[model samples]
Target: MQFETCHIPGLVIVTPKVFSDSRGFFFEAYNRKPFEEAGITANFVQDNQSQSSYGVIRGLHFQRNPFAQSKLVRVLQGTILDVGVDIREGSPTFGQHFSIELSAENKKQLFLPAGFAHGFSVLSETAIVAYKCDNYYSKESEGGIRYDDPELAIDWKIDPAKAIVSGKDLELPLLSESFANFTY
Candidate 1:
């Protein structure tokens, strides 16, 4: 496997070595040693999965400290435009965002450290997104920024009129209006 860090510190892209033939393909999805070598030492405690159709947007979400989660997300089927936004105060890339395409064909994965808000837009007819999180979810600690916040100016690649966002996500405050307490 090859682990590459993005411009934002602690965000990594993991590409597994796949051995494929006419039959199928095989690769190690997770291994403790290689991950530790790559500087990712989070002890994943929960796994979550979701399915969404084209135009569906889920997230721009994060948890406050003590309940902050580090996530390793991948597309199990179909494709999605994955996004991670840094909210860590005092960090060089704070408020900056990163976007990537994850698909079953490419088998790429993203590791988003704590202090980052995450979300994805489905690009295919349907997509299965799965992730491993280092911390358990806390409803009270849940917080997020609007997916279409202009200051961040994320291009979700889906038409605004076509976006299928949840009511709660639609109600999420914009970064400028947020009271998040993330730190560097």
Candidate 2:
């Protein structure tokens, strides 16, 4: 496995070496040793998966400090425009976001540390995304920033007219009004 850091600290892009034969291909998605060597020591405690149709946008969400989670996300099928935003207070990159295309073919993954908010938009007909989180989820600790926050100005790479977002997500606060629970 190879780990590449993004402009935002603690955010990493991971590429796994794949072996292919006449029948199929194989790669290790997560291995403790290599991850620790790469400076990602997240002890994942929960696994989550979701499936969405094209244009479906999921989030810009995070949990408060006590329930904060670091995640490793990858696509199991189809493709998506995955996004991560830096929200850690006092960090130089706070409010900036990073976007990447993840697909079954590319076999790439994004690792987002606890201080970031995460979201994705489906770019294919359908997509199945899976992720590992370092901490368990807490409903009371949940918080989010609006995906379309003008301050963040994230280009979800989808037509706004056709974008599908949940009412809950649409009601999330903007970056400036979001809950402050992280510090650099």
Candidate 3:
């Protein structure tokens, strides 16, 4: 596996070395030693999966400190535009966001440390997205930023007129009104 650092601190793009033959292909999805050596030390304790169709957008979500989570996300069956926004109070890239295309074909993953808000937009007919979290979820600790927050100005790749978002996510606060207790 190879870990590539993003311009934003604590964000990593992990590419696995896949071996393929006429029969099929294989790769180690997760290995503690190599990950730790790469400076990605999260001890994942929970796994979550979701399915969405093209035009569906979920996120800009995070858990408050004490319940904050570090996540490693990937697409198992299709394609998506995965995004992460830095919300750490004192970080140089605070309020900035990064995005990448993850698909079953590429076999890549995104590792987001605890201080960022995360989300994704399905780009395929249907997508199966899964992620590992270092901490369990807590409803009381739930927090998020509006996916269309003008300040952040994320390009979801999907046309806004056709984008499908849940009422809950649509109600999230804009970046200016959002708060993050985590600091760099």
Off by over 4 Å in 2: none
lDDT of 1 by residue, 1-184 (tens): 9999989998999999999999999999888899999999999999999999999999899999789999999989999999999998888998899999999989999999999999999999999999999999999999999999999999999999999999999999998888668888
lDDT of each: 0.94, 0.96, 0.95
52-88 per-residue lDDT for model 3 (tens digits): 9999999989999899999999989999999999999
Report the C-alpha displacement of residue 119, candidate 2, in angstroms: 0.3
Question: What is the lDDT, from 0 to 100, of the residue 46 in candidate 3?
Answer: 100
Give candidate 1's whole-model lDDT.
Answer: 0.94
TM-score-superior candidate, 1 or 3: 3
lDDT of 2 by residue, 99-178 (tens): 99999999999999999999999999999999999999999999999999999999999999999999999999999999
- Candidate 1's displacement at residue 153, Å, is 0.4
TM-score of candidate 2 to 2 decimals: 0.99
